[model samples]
Target: MLRITPRILAVACIASGLITAACASYAPTPSSDLAGTSWAVQSIDGQPTSARSPSVEFAAEDRISGAGGCNSFSGVYEAANGAISVRALGRTEMACEGGVMLQEDAFFAVLDGAERYARQQDRLVITADDGRALVLAPL
Candidate 1:
């Protein structure tokens, strides 16, 4: 047999209410402004790197178009709420010497394996499942 007490019932109700409120607060909110806009790479892991602050533009057709330093690149983008992914990227080959080429190569390599995206204030962050993150800001 089980007995119900007022104190126990009150605690249970309070716990349930707190859990519900926590879940609601943590839920991600989708931003329509993020779509169909251009953004520029700002900093990586809080370090300043101007190697190539390329711009990315999202399209209504689920595509992402951007300039990879000296070359142009395009890819497919899929996003929902707080999650975003880019796939099947293709880029033009243009000769760029010095640090620009190196930066472009690094940037493209990161994008090729990008698995998730997050927005923080005015910055957009792309990340891999391994925890590596890249930050970008509005252009």
Candidate 2:
């Protein structure tokens, strides 16, 4: 028969409690800075653009608001443990000429796959697993 002495049972209970506490402490807290912040797109692949870069700003709650070249856009954002997902993005439909449309499309594409984000001073850096980065400054 398998037997556990009182001391052994106490030790096992203590170990389990310690592990639970450690895990709870290590869990990530939802970012508060992400709310009410405006970020101006800086660079993609380390190249600067003379054209006006796209910008993203967040609301106080689950909404992500931004500008895509000639139009304003808004969406919902969900993030956990460095992974980000955007959904229900609704943008104003405006006719943008030439490069503006192209830039907007590219900006949306990158944001759709954002995996992680970091803050550097007044700047925000969003990155993907493939080493692609989008640097932005607070507006």
lDDT scores in order? 0.75, 0.77
lDDT tens digits, residues 67-127, model 1?
8778899988777766677888989988987777767776776677677788888888887
Q: Please give, for residues 1-139, the per-residue lDDT of candidate 2 as tens digits.
A: 9699999999999999999988785544444568677888888657653377888887666689888778888888876555666778888989888788877777777777677887778878888656677888888
Tell me the TM-score of model 2. 0.68
In model 2, which regions exceed 4 Å deviation? 1-31, 129-131
- On the 0 to 100 scale, the lDDT of residue 98 in model 2 is 73
TM-score of 1: 0.68
RMSD of 2: 8.3
